[model samples]
Target: MSKALEPAGPSDGVNRWGLVDLFAGCGGASAGFLATGAFDHLWAADNDRWAAATYEKNLGHEVATVDLLEVAESSADVWAAGIRARHRGPICLVGGPPCQGFSSHVKVRGDSRGRNTLYGAFVTLAIALEPEVVVIENVPDLFATRNWELFADARSRLSDAGYRVRARILNFAEFGVPQERFRAVVIASRADHPEVRFPAPTHAQGAFSSVQEWIGELSPVASGEVAEDDAMHQASRHSKATLEIIRQVPADGGNRPIGVGPECLDRTRTSHGGYTDVYGRLAWQTTAPTITARCRTPSCGRFIHPEQHRGLTAREAALLQTFPSNWHFVGPFDDRFKQIGNAVPPLAARRIAEAVLSGGSHSEAGVVEIGDEPIGSSFSVLIPGIRRRGGRLAEGN
Candidate 1:
């Protein structure tokens, strides 16, 4: 957005730009951006110590463990001066704020959720740094009726700060992530530069990378078995009843057999309203369901291995999320799953980085408003403007 200086070309033998990642969960976004070899990692911050350690381990950059709220509360000018001194080149600010408040899976939905406003901290930093481009990622439900006002507020604030703001609901599967994950991405570019455009889909319906392609090569491990070579390939120990239920589930994308799970899952029961994907197996040839923090458990969504009688290993889940096999996660088993599930797929992030590098052209297909369904409904209710095609949402022009 700052026209005075452009990113240096590869011929110049100089780093093009500086990247500052906020709320960097294990450096997924940073990993992708760095893969393009266009930006230098200037700084990264996250509150979780384990996540910080993991980021430092993989990215070779120290992550500030302080909460961003404190950073936002400090003297903006002082922080801006310090950051500018470190990297004089153009800067890009990228991050995904904590999205639990806007996640459709959460039981509670409202403006009162404190985490809902954390995006403001990101906005505060962006204004202070006056970065050329700012990218904010979150759950698509950020556009839901309940949170639309907050979404609008963020756009307005960035616009008032002299940025041209655009937003879109992007399916990660379209970007070749081996899972079906949708996220709302907001990109704001300073008025001087061309509007930052959303990246086009690199993979389409039947051509999407399959779950088997990502994880099938990992040595098969039964429930409670740990691969000797890959410690992260360890599987969770299932109870006898849970193992029996998993055994009853047929291979390759089978739903839990009738009466195989809890009574709440029984369709004949009057109170039966549970999710059907619970305890289901993923199809080997199709993209996986959205990987969540609970992906290590068989009862959480369609997490069970296609043919194995166990849920996904942490390593397998990371693969489905498009993490490299060599990327090591540091934490307890559950914590490792949380880090992997919360990451923005590096492949999707790489496409976004490439778009930024190309100085994208404006597109009318950027923003898609959601329907006015109950926020807590189990199913996503998209309006006619956005249609489901081949498991991916097509943007209305």
Candidate 2:
């Protein structure tokens, strides 16, 4: 059964891929990977119990509720063996670690120790499992940070381990995702001919057709559009002044509709000036602003739900995340929002996964490897390091 796994086509055959989704949150990434029916997901992990439960119930993946580092260390070997015994080739891994340390939303302290270390955990597992391929994804801000050099070290470590690594920042909007989200994706191959390429954007940019295009169909919900289902989808009503400005914005007008004149402008905002994209309406024909964990708040982004006077519902956000209408999210409403906001849009993920999985120029072995050491952290391997599945793995001498 191993090595016989088939890539699920757009429809025809079942896509069967062996996978372990680390940092799996509500199965968004897995949803993307599975949307094309490309792979059979085997396992997923997140320390958050609710997230694990949600993933388990929704995607049918075996969910593990534990820290990534601890779980990988304890059962890496068995995990590898189970994968080998069950599927073909080494397993493929996908996920992005928490971006809190690198996000502008949070304060970065002490050289990003907490944040940098998280990336280290991903690197540690890659080295131990020696998986045939690894797919790492994160926000655009993740690349903006010099404080965390895990990307550099990870590239180098993969290179040394007989792999070929490709890291680049990609804008999701260009890749056919309805929103204008940007991300950083790194694809490493343990194959002889490693091909790394970003997915081409299927959407064309037009003045009338920017980020608000997809959100126009939703029933108009306001900043307070919370349903009994998910509280996070409740839009935070704007202040009187903000609402006044919002009222002026035409149905088709965005932030541009209401200029930041003296009354609309805050003296303190001369520097940053105005909410970045929050409390802004979506153009009837354009894509929405990049969906965020705070996507439910009209005050947070241009999330004013299309026609609804309030922000989007959790379901609407998931729609923007490219989740199919019939697919399910298993968790509290707010939690589902976090999962959707945190996901790699299924359409985006599927396209990228297709490229990485089939981008090989040759049928021969491929190895994804790093080329240099990162600005911070150790790339050298020591004996008896952590494992992937469960239980301790002996290190190489």
Candidate 3:
């Protein structure tokens, strides 16, 4: 539990809409909502202590470090009751549950099932709180053949609760994020209110904001250099061998050199098929790759700086994720990168909040088809164990 870095109160006399954020990592989505000047953050919760601390520091609000799955299973009514008592206006519930299960980057089957159903906890809170609007965000793989049933089940539950729901896969770059990150988003509105519409793209592919425009102006630092004025701008120190490999790779969008680095990454290795982005430098004029929790190192992905020989610093990564330069992330270096990588870009989130406030086109009251099997099929059998386990989806054969 960390104290807010500043006073935690909304401005006076605005009559802003209320928002309750679950899985509120570093307040990224909440930042977007609040940036619209149409919402006041009433409550936010996440299990990560450092992330909660970061949220409190940057958002000027306290975040409860509670396990949402436990709360949804045993005490949703109790929790929702407290929120309801605090605010009596129209409320929007927004969250992105642990999404590793639905991410293409995850290879292990066992690792995927545990958090796959955490969105159920989100649904539980939505049903209990009865928010006027509900939003769920996750990796685009949520609509894949393997995970579609779980997504269908969540949508079915929301629809049964009188919400007109629609799901879409949105690229954050189109919404002005300087990264080519794709996420599946579900927005639901109560039957009485206008359906929640997805916002139109604000930036086309060719005209997207570039990495140069975002972080190029920051003071340059070598691999082991630390900025005295800003801890977030400090770059990670790399090994001598790693530095040699990065130096060999051309600057500005260079791929891992063949037969040059570790033998494990060599073309002769059997496991070196699809990892083209490993040890690669980002292109200055184009959008950066999706920043992951491991983005502080070059071995993880194409996180190496465009011209520098080290991976991206936390500040650069945060800026690529559309977090404001002044947004303070509280934690050790690794923890700060994790918070930034896991956050929904505030710019994209602002568009979503604005769409909710705009009362745009009324979507139909069911799942939006983006190439998946129809709901209520034989796949329905997969959902019971998820609900019974509280949140973890059963390992299906």
The Cα local distance difference test for each model comes to 0.78, 0.59, 0.78
Q: Alpha carbon lDDT of residue 285, candidate 2?
A: 66
lDDT per residue (tens digit) for residues 109-178 in model 3: 3433333246767888899999999988887677766677667777788889999887866667777788
Query: Tell me, what's the RMSD of every candidate?
Result: 5.9, 11.0, 8.9
Off by over 4 Å in 1: 1-11, 99-116, 268-274, 362-379, 383-397
User: Top TM-score: which candidate number?
Assistant: 1
Alpha-carbon error at 248 in model 3, in Å? 0.9
Taking all chains together, each candidate's TM-score versus the true structure is 0.87, 0.74, 0.84
Off by over 4 Å in 3: 1-15, 99-117, 268-273, 361-397
Candidate 1 residues 1-397, lDDT tens each? 0110122345253547789999999988988887777888898999888888889998899998876766675676687788899997778899998634334422344444333346766787888999988988888877766676566777778889999887777777777788877788888899987677788777776787889888888899999999999998989999999999999998999988777879777764336555778889999999998999999898878999999999999999888877778788998888999999888888878878877767755332233533333233212655222334434344333
Tell me the TM-score of model 1: 0.87
In candidate 3, list every pair of residues with a backbone clash. none
Off by over 4 Å in 2: 1-16, 72-75, 99-116, 193-196, 207-213, 220-248, 256-265, 268-276, 360-397
The better-scoring model by lDDT among 1 and 2 is 1
User: How many residue pairs clash (N, CA or C atoms closer than 3 angstroms) in each of the candidate models, in the order given?
Assistant: 0, 61, 0
Report how far residue 25 has shifted in candidate 2, in Å: 0.6
